[model samples]
Target chain A: MDVTNRIERALTEALSQADLAGCPPRLAAAMRSAVFPRGARVRPRLCHSVAAACGDDNPATEAAGAALELMHCASLVHDDLPCFDGADIRRGRPSVHKAFGEPLAVLTGDALIVLAFQTIARVNCAPDRLLKLTQVIGSAVGVPLGIVAGQAWECESEINLAHYHRSKTGALFVAATAAGAASAGADPEPWRMVGEKIGEAYQVADDLRDAAADEDEIGKPVGQDVAHDRPSAVREMGIDGAVYHLKSLVRGAVEAMPPCSNGNELRSLIMSEATRLVPAKLAQSAA
Target chain B: MDVTNRIERALTEALSQADLAGCPPRLAAAMRSAVFPRGARVRPRLCHSVAAACGDDNPATEAAGAALELMHCASLVHDDLPCFDGADIRRGRPSVHKAFGEPLAVLTGDALIVLAFQTIARVNCAPDRLLKLTQVIGSAVGVPLGIVAGQAWECESEINLAHYHRSKTGALFVAATAAGAASAGADPEPWRMVGEKIGEAYQVADDLRDAAADEDEIGKPVGQDVAHDRPSAVREMGIDGAVYHLKSLVRGAVEAMPPCSNGNELRSLIMSEATRLVPAKLAQSAA
Candidate 1:
């Protein structure tokens, strides 16, 4: 099956696990809302693509991808709460907190995080591969370099742009590539650079969109960096510079891929995704 | 080492994993505050004690116990949030939200939850044993019957006392016993009842305290169950009936032990803990 189908099916199965007998309906629904009407599914796709490139299509790889996606969704749910971004709309619909109230939203995020790990644990795989996948995936969502640390950076008086971006966006991508490789019984260390570069490229594109794109284009509020006074590529570098930097990161990502048996397909996928990152108009203007 | 020291050291190691170099200082501090100056440390003790009873003192068992404690702590931190219990103190000091603000508290809880799973994942145990331990521990914190569901019950329009108590308190205790057994390379299913009875007994004692003990005795605000109009044994059964229930549950816990080699030691530990669950005056009054 295709990567998207694999990810969606895996995710559905995982959520069904959470939607077990006696689960509070609202909490389950809140978790669903945070995940469905998917937002790009970039992380999972990256995970699956890398695993495929590593010449393995193991069920554990799909599970790890789903786990990464769930972690991303969980982070979004928590990040949109009143304490953080306070975003009302996500994926062009009401955010989890907005739809399910704050308390259920909190529990939803917590449940999803647990579900992420549980999804991996439930997969029947070689124990060694499972252990490596769990460690890589777990580290991506935790401190001191995981998304949790990434969010905590916002609370500090002074923030390091590199640290914030890496933790918030890059860590999971790193997990994606590394875990995918690990799931395929390959060395994961060489895959880390690909993830890091792609993650950096994605963040730069996001900043460019936040700075230059229309609100309707992104499906969320624009100029949040200025409103929240968050440091971003656009704020540090000019729009042109940020766009140029994004291109460099994308190229770097393609160059960083470890030599695998099926590298061409993964490379094409990354290139296509890179093209999609910038809005058409922005891409044209930058060109 | 003794159980207490084992639990404390394991917990310290787990927390240090979160206290890494680039972690935001306040977030790190908040995570520490939520855990340190420990409460009863009941869950970990139960876990370690059960592991001992199962004829294993593996480091993985200690790590499982620590993971359980961290999950308990994470639940408490989130439970005390403004959207939930809205408490101002825990363990006789300012709660996580009160001490470090709501946002950090949220992140701290999130970080701790991740740390719990990461703790189990990082343990150098047999792969099959580690996988089983992760599944047991993960189930105790997620959905259907995890603490998150327990908290979600409070958000629902109607609450079932059995479901609430089981998910909220019993789940982790079940995790403790079951994970301990799993870590010890034993079947965890038989140990579930021991955990269930103990957890129920502890909750009953807590209800009695809420209804009958002073604030000073419990180290936090008293009368919260009544204040929040939550379901409780004291409310469902009168104070005397609740006390009677507590004693019965404690007896049941001892009887539920799975006939391990060190059952006598574990039974004695349970009896001693049961005696301590209720205040001296309350125990005497009930007698």
Candidate 2:
């Protein structure tokens, strides 16, 4: 099956276990909406692609990839909450909070996160690999250095922009690569650098879009970085400089791919992904 | 260390790693307060006592016990949110949301939930046991049959009262027992009924207290069951019948302990716990 099909199947099966039959109708609908009508689903794609590069067709890898996407979606749901970004639109639709009300939105995010790990736990794998996958994903979503910590940084008076970017965006990207490797029964350490670079590049690209693109063009509210005084590459380095940094990060990502049987294929994958991730204007300029 | 000391130390160590230095003071403070001014810590006590009864003192048990406490604490934080219970006070102090504002309360709950699993991942255990630990806790906290589903039940127009009580309260108790057994490298399935009965007994006790105790005696709001029209034994079965039911449930809990080396000791422990869990007024009447 294609990565998208695998992810869709895994997510659908996993969510079905949520027993929405007994839950509030709106909450169930909101969770379905938050997951389906998917975004680019870049994280899971990156995860499966890396697992494939490692010569793995393991079900664990598929589960890991699906779990990563669930976490990503959960993060987006919470990030759009009024307490955080307060974004009303996401992926060309109303945010979960905007559609379901704040209470259900909160529960949706919480349930998705629980389901993410539960999804991984049910994957048929050797205990060791499953344990490692759990650890990898847990650390990525957790505190002190995880995405939650990354978001918490925003509440601080003087935020470390680099740490914020790395935690908020880079953490999940790193988890995708590391967990993909772990699920394939390979060492996860080497994949970290590759994931970090991609994560940083994606954040930079988001900053560029936030600064330069129209809200309608982006399909969501724009200029949020400036409005919230959030730390952003575009705000810190200027649009042109941020674009330059993104290109450099993508180059670094390609260089960081671990030597493997499919090293060339993985490099090509990263290159193509880099192009897709970079803002169109920035990509055109760089080209 | 004793269970209380061990719990205190474990929670302190876990919260310390949340990178509070970089997080907002209020967020950090709220997380701390949510944990510190501890409730009865009954769940961890039960977990540790069960592990001890099973002849296991591994650090994995400590970690599991600590993780369960963290999950319980996280649930309390979210449960006390304005949208849910709007509880103004807890444990003789301002509830997390009331003290630190809603946003921080929400984030604090999220971070703590993440920390709960992270705490387990860091435990020194065989990978198999670790995998089981994750499954047990995740299952207890996740959808369909977890505490999250229990809370979601309130949002529904009609709830199966048995399922609601089991998910909302019994799930964690089951998790505590199952996790403790898993930590000890024992089969966890047998321990679940023990946990479920204790949980049900505790909930009934809570209902009795809520309906009958003074606010100062309970050290939080009273009459909440009636206020919200929440399902409760006291409301459903009446004060006398509920008291009779609490005794019966406690007796069942004692009878449900799995055949183990410390069977008598564990039975006695449950009996004492049953005494403590039932309110004095109810106990007097039942006696």
Q: Residue by residue across A49-85, what tens digits does model 1's lDDT show? A: 8888999978999899989999999998999999899
Q: List the TM values for chain B, per candidate.
A: 0.97, 0.96
Q: Where does model 1 exceed 4 Å of error?
A: none
DockQ of all candidate complexes: 0.82, 0.54
Query: How high is each candidate's TM-score?
Result: 0.98, 0.95
Q: Model-by-model lDDT, in order?
A: 0.88, 0.82
Error of 2 at A35 (Å): 1.2
> Least accurate stretch of 10 residues (summed lDDT) in model 2 chain A?
A18-27
Which number leads on lDDT? 1
- The per-residue C-alpha lDDT of model 1 at residue A265 equals 78
lDDT of 1 by residue, B107-218 (tens): 8899999999899889888988888988998888998889999899888887766778999989998888898889889999999999999988888888888888888888
